[model samples]
Target: MQGFWDCMSLWKLLLKGKKGCHVSSCRVRRLMKKKLPQAWRKSAVDLEDCLKQERSLYKQAKHTYAAQWRKDFLTVQTKDAKKHQWKSRKARDRFFRLQQMKQREEARHRCCAQSKGSTGDLQAIQIEEHLSDGTTSLRTITDRRLVEDGCMQETRHAMIKHERRHSPVHLQVSKDDHVYFWPRNPENKGSKPHGLHNGHFKAAIQSPSIAYCDALFRNIPLTTGFVPLQWQNLMNFAIKKKPGDFRLSKMRTIQLMNSEAQANNKKAGRAAMQFAEAHSLIPDGQCGSCKRHQAIDLALSKQLVWDLLILQRRAAGWISNDAKSCFDWVAIVTMLLFGLTWHVLSSMFNMLSFATRRICTGFGDSKRSFCPPSAVPFQGCGQGNGAAPHLDLGDTVHHSGEDICASVQAAATLWLGGIRATGGAINPEKSFWWLIDFEWDARNGQWRFCRKCSAAPEFDLKIPGLYSDIEPLRRLEPDDSERTLGVMLSPLENHNAQEAQLVSKGLGVPHLFGKQVYKHLEMILRHMLGGTKPGAYMDANLQAHQLETGTSFGLLQQDYQNTSILASDTWLKRVWKELESLDMYVAFDSPALSLRWHHDALLIDLFIDLEVDQDDLLWLNWCRMFLQVATVSDITTADGRYIRQCIWNGFRDDTYRTPYNWPRTVRPGRPYWELWQRTLSRALLPSHGQHHPLLQPLGHWHDNFESWNWLWSPTVGLFHREGAAWTHLALAGSSTISRRYAPSGSHSGTDSLQ
Candidate 1:
């Protein structure tokens, strides 16, 4: 029946004589139009083309008739002739519209048919056609089903879904995992590196009674979060049992556990040795000074041991003199209350750590190992991420030794108040000790303590140069570097007399960059030769990742879909491996780089003299690769394709601005330096994303700005410039080089250093 209606519609087009079809027939045609497309598909033969031909013929006939009518009407000159002409014109326009509708419908039907028969993939096929008139046409066959603007985006996203699912860098994070990477037992294959590896960070320091022990020995106030009940009982017991000299003698005995017992008490030292051996504090076979030192260290860590020792010291009449010299009860009480007050206030507003350059030591420095152990989850003081608490006693203004001790303890306790407020506890795996010694200067008739802080050359080492007559003091003992608070009064160390100095603090600008380059080379070498462990990946959980990727890439962990995952590409890893095995280290003979401080907070402030070998291709190539790899960072995007580019160009110079004075590469080697210079030129310095760029500073201000300063503005954009400013204090201190190495202006003309 639908086919019959379709045939009737075709007939209606042929028989133009009929002004209108019957109402019942039109109703049947409308109903058939809905149902007959599939049924007539096999029989369809381009009826719309036939209709076009018929319409053209009708228009030709009409024009002829109109011409004759006009000839006839030329004599008539009547309004009726004009009226008939208007009617004809209206009929012609209506037919043209109907023809266009039919053509469009037929084209749509043909497209749908072609789509159904297609067996190829969804890839767009580009069609190019050359015309005789020397023109070409291009057409892309796309999925018409998803051709809408929004749907096309959805289609693109689906293609890379597998890559996103299979990514290894974004592994699932857990509550137990420390926010920062920490070392775990390499032996325990099953255990994750959650900061809880045994011998990594012990849990004994978390005990409440240690506060009382610290209070007794150092007269320090109790930590902010410690429960008062535990302290009250421990204090009561210490007061009731005044063991006096007996306790001191016992500690002396325990201190010499490995030595043979005296004739008067033959079993004492042997029994102590047996206990130390059982606890694995000392090696079973070793029985000497080393074993005794280890046992003393282990014993001092225990609260019960401390309590017993305190009683013995009280009995020996030594506690009173020691307490009088160091303990300031009034100050201790004041600071204890101050910590508790801050603890209460921190509930509303998070307590913040102090911001200063001196306190910028990162917990992740491999050599210093300042970070607390894995077991102690450092939530960080209220100061935000990358900021560490300042525990340097020299920062205190107090002059008296006892007052200084009291102030340092108070500061530590108060800092802990903030830590405790956020559910973090100290890890006592290793004691953190501060060695204080005063040297008597006969020239000035005063005693002074030397604090060798790492600062600029202007503030060099605090050597006692004033007292020339002062003799060499005793050397620091092996046990002096212990972590916990143990007051050992000893003379100043004869630092110059010893073959090896106790402190190896890198000083001045030269040592700073030399150490940095050395370290970077070492790290690259180590990773390349040995191949870093597969799972040694840093977590990118910064909120900026989500914000920049529009929340598509986020913290939510998905099941990995790929067969394998890698933190770095194979080429990168291979490059490092090759560099590691390179015997170029021996061939690289160059003068040491010299650096001097100029007191500018930015790289522009300092100057460096680097000796580069222009003739050595190996050195040039190494420098190029090192600079490229060091500065090239992969921008985080939803798609995994690496858009590797230099992220530090904001700190370098460009054509418009000769701000950063990067070292000049000469003649043939100029290309290497030029390429590096171009990479650094990627970012516009001080970009405000505003219309007028003229307002921003140029030249020296642009080049020497403290781009790495912790308090520096985020707009300078040495690294990440898109979202919130990344404020890692350590990054600011060590991430830049002296301006002399990176001199401004072109070195295009000559090869000489001058």
Candidate 2:
């Protein structure tokens, strides 16, 4: 019987889920297993006998015990669930009747327009009237639910799924002026978040305007892949008004379309066409004299410049994951937890939720344009160069391959032109670009593609594919296999195993699904506490490596984003491989990128406008001298003008963004103020661990140094004042140590320093 229970235990963790019942059920079952007769275990050997003898009784016992445990585990949740529920039908009726009575009495006392201290039917009805404007207000009738406006505001934003909960779909003449909501009270003991997008993040993004809607673009990605040739042809045709008088690229003529709320909420395609026509491209200012090159046409130059900059930035580091790692974790976990998470288990129940095999974003919202509250009427600043109509994937799907290719290029060109200097943030982006790559499979029939689209570089030249196709969930990849002492391990080990079974395999969190997670986890455990092999590593080197370089400082995992990479493959590979040894990386781009090499780190940075471009090389040289990279060679050009460069670096010699960390923005300013080694080293190192160096919040440097400052707090190694000691732990400038007095030429002394 004990063996039989153990067998079930391995498979049925998610199967026997309840609000809080997991721990207790295990205890009770264990107790029963100990008490059961040894002969009874033999009855479970034969399938028929096992079922006939004790299956029902075992299930009943487990269920009863599990339920009790769950009640205890989630007592707060259990209580919260009863917020609005009545005990019986009669009680429910009585509550409503009382609400009605109160409303009637209020009507007699106050104006029908406004009622205070009211939790009556009239208030509810009035709120309903207001809701017509397309708003969904999550209300908490009890005062205890009223959280401080500032404190719980973030939580409130999370509840409003802008995609589904658009602010009151239609405008309504609302009678209730005061919109009551379930306020967040941080002081409440039971207060906790239930989903992604926590308080601070939600607070930052909340906008109480119209429904959180995305820009409706007509040429959105489609069911069937568009033909690259046809797409390009369409764009060429659109722009062929006259050769010299280049007009807006065909792709620039974007239009918006509404998206369905749910997958099955399909509307007529004709309505979509109507939407496209209604919201056609924004006008671009025309040329006053020569019609040759309108602003729209000239804007390409800007786009071209931006494209190059993006390439440069990408080389620096900004990547998106294409391993589908995010989706896989969710699928596996959902499967493992199917028995427990769902309301009730079915005979056909699988631990993982097969149907919910979707990508799970940590918290950041999807990449939709963020616009102000009002839709500003766009006038063509440059002929056909301003706000154009949005494009959607669906329209492009119906188009030919040639048109699709052309559209893609045209869009890319336009996108590249609108670049701006966002200080350090802009440099890596300007240097390199990261594009997500996906494989094609025909396992599912959801997608169709044109095989020949490859030659055009506008579409996949590899093969036709669909999005519906995916491989089955892998139970345990060898890469992720960790070994613990099978014999000595306790029955209930509360460690990453639980996280793996639930969050990783069951809930399917994406980050943990990757190969890197396993590698890092092994390093982390070995460094912290010794355990068995595979599951627990005793590799001191690996642990020390993680301690000094990697982010597994005995923590579960590291969180980072905004990875970019230069277009140079050789450079990217070299940089990544190098980082493998040093562990100085925080993805400026995706992991799959190749970067361009920059011997002159500062020289390879962003210059507002290309020509009048700042001598980044000279700047880097200056930095190296100041930061104490004085002995570090190969950081400059022979002529000393800093290596002449462009964003189009492809060759190994051409500067790229890889071998780069942080890929900092080099805004045009006091170039010689800091050392190149310090700046580059700072960029190379992730702002992780206990010691992060602060670049004295002085100068017109930047404001968003929060992530950087936090990641690389004081290195606490050394310091150099004007008179006293001097060391270069983690402060800014290897050579620019904290000096009490100005010593020489070129070094400007600030009053604050004195």
- TM for every model, in the order presented, reads 0.17, 0.15
Candidate 1 lDDT, 353-466, residue by residue in tens: 111111111242123212111211112222111111110003221132333444444555555444334333332211232323233333332224433231111221111111
Across residues 636-679, which tens digit of lDDT does each residue of candidate 2 receive?
Answer: 23222232221111112222112222211222224234333334
Worst 10-residue lDDT window, candidate 2: 256-265
lDDT of 2: 0.26
Residue 726, model 2: lDDT of 26
lDDT of 2 at 238: 22
